[model samples]
Each structure stands twice: as C-alpha cells, then as structure tokens.
Target: KHRWAMYIDVSKCYGCYACVAACAAENNVPIGVFRTWIERHVTKGGTVIFVPKQCNHCENAPCVKACPTGATYKRTEDGLVLVNDDLCIGCGACIQACPYGARFFNPVKGVVDKCTFCEHRIYQGKLPACVETCPTGARVFGDLNDPESPVSQLVKKMPTSRLKEWTGAEPMIFYRDLPSEADL
Candidate 1:
C-alpha cells in the first residue's frame, strides 16, 4: 500500500507564493480561500522564515471523525484525507475539527474542501501542482511506504517536525529544518 506524504524543507523556502497560486488554479479554489498557503514568520532576532501550510492527511484525522454526513474520510490505500462533495452538507464541522485549519467551507461549492495532495495528478504519475511549481525545490511528495522514495529517505535522514503533534492527529506532513521559534 502506498502511504502518500510530503516533506517540506523550511530552510529552502523563500516565501514565494507559487504553490499558493498553483493550488488555486489547479483546484479552482474560491477567491478568498486556499488549499495550500505560505506563512511568513519572523523570529525575535528578525530573521524571516517561510512555512508552507496545508492538509497533513493525518492517520487520525479529526475532520474525518467530525463530519456528520460521512463526507470526510481518510483513504486507507494512500492515506489521503478527502471530502465527498455529494455527501457533504456544508455544516462546517470538519472545518472546526481540523487542527491545522486546512479545511475551508467552499462558498462556491457550499461544502468543506481541502488539499487532496493533488490526488488526480498523483494517480496520473504527475507531481502535485504545489510541488511542481516550487522553484526552490522545497516540497517533496512520494509514497512513505516505499524505502526508495524521496519522502521516505528525507524523513529517515533529516530532522523534521509536524504541526500540532500533541493533538495526536498523526499528521503526515513533515517539515525539515523548521526553526524552533516559528511558533508552529
């Protein structure tokens, strides 16, 4: 089984919003919301850091549990958390349950929506728009279950962190070289 995952090298990010734009264009995300976005943080010493934020596609996703209509679910095969629009009631339960604030109520669709790690493209053997558009090569996406995958190798060899670890959501998105002072 393929376990899809992403590795973000914080040290390589330069605050470019190419990922953001690509995600919007690829997913047809509404004007005011995003599936993936970049956050700019400055430490006390005034050093700027860019952190990319998106759905972690957690192993224990709160959004999956929170959806009353069974619209949100985690796919066991690839471990991708996805929303079933036909089942979605646009109740915003998943939005509130997401610790990473990755889910959004799509005004256009009237349903909760978020990153699918570009599932359509991935299954077609293409990279996610965010990963492909990243000029800095900061984002790496692959099957974590594959020993030879880049994501697997990076996680094995690099120091990494996931957001809101205490929540026990078991987020799959990993950040390499994340500064301690970035305030999550």
Candidate 2:
C-alpha cells in the first residue's frame, strides 16, 4: 500500500526558514497565517534547536471526519489528507480537532486551511516545495510503504517519533535527534 510520510532530522536543522517560506510561496498560503511554522527550542545544556512543524496527516484524521461539509478527505493513493475548498463551510471544526494546531482559518478564502503535503507538486513527481528547497536536506519525503526509501531506512536505523502519539492519530511524519525540550 502506498503511504505518505515526512522525516525531519533535527540534527541537520539550523533554524533556516527556507522550508517555511517555500511552503508558503508554493501553496499560496495567506498572510498572517501559516500552514506550517518552525519553533526554536532551547535545552538546559544551552543547546538551541530548530523544529519544523506541520500537519501529521493522521491515519484516523479527526480533521477529515469532523468536517461537516465533507471537504476534508484522505487520498487513497498517497494518504495525504486534503481539503476541498469548494465544499468547505469554514466551520473551523477541523482546526480544533487537530491536536498539533496545524489547521488555520484563511481570512482571504473564508475557509479553513491546512497543509496538503504539496499535492500539486507531488502529482508532478516532484518533491514538495519545502523539501525541494531545503538547503540542509532536513526534510525527507517519500512513500513510507517502500522499505527501500531513505525515509524508511532512517525510521529503521534511528529512534524516531511523532507528536501526540497518545492521541492515536497515527501520524505519518517522523522526527529524529529531537532534543527533549522540543518534545515534538
């Protein structure tokens, strides 16, 4: 089965906002709202860390199930949960359902907006804008179903984890070398 996943190596991140700006420009994400954002985490050892944040594309997506207008749905081909703008009612229910606070209301479009995993670029067999523009190659995207993929290999070779695992969202994104202060 084809599946979607993103692996971020925190050790490689250097507080570069490349991923943030790239995603915004590619997706046309509105101003004053971010589809994704990066947080700076500082630990007791005086070690500062950069953590990129975005939707987890949960297996049991509460955002998808909570949309009253049937706007949010998961792609069967790649498992990227997306919103249908035309069908969206701007109820903002999904925004609350997301534990990571990844969803936001777009004042310009008058609907809820969240990450689409760059479906536009992915459909062209190209990487997401953020992943493509990452200078450090910190963000890795691939079909996690393929054991040979770099993301799969990293998952196998390292102790990685996702956010809010107790929520049972079954997040597809993984993080490695995360400092305890980040706790993502």
- Candidate maximizing TM-score: 1
- Where's the lowest-lDDT run of ten residues in candidate 2? 175-184
lDDT of 1: 0.92
Error of 2 at 1 (Å): 4.2
- Candidate 1 lDDT over residue span 47-109, tens digit each: 899999999999999999999988899898889999999999888988899888898988899
Q: After superposition, how far is residue 104 of candidate 2 from its true place, in Å?
A: 0.7
Query: Estimated TM-score per prediction?
Result: 0.97, 0.94
**How far out, in Å, is residue 39 in model 1?**
0.8
Q: Which residue pairs in model 2 clash with each other?
A: none
**Model 2, 147: alpha-carbon shift in Å?**
2.1
Q: Name the weakest run of 10 consecutive residues (lDDT summed) in model 1.
A: 175-184
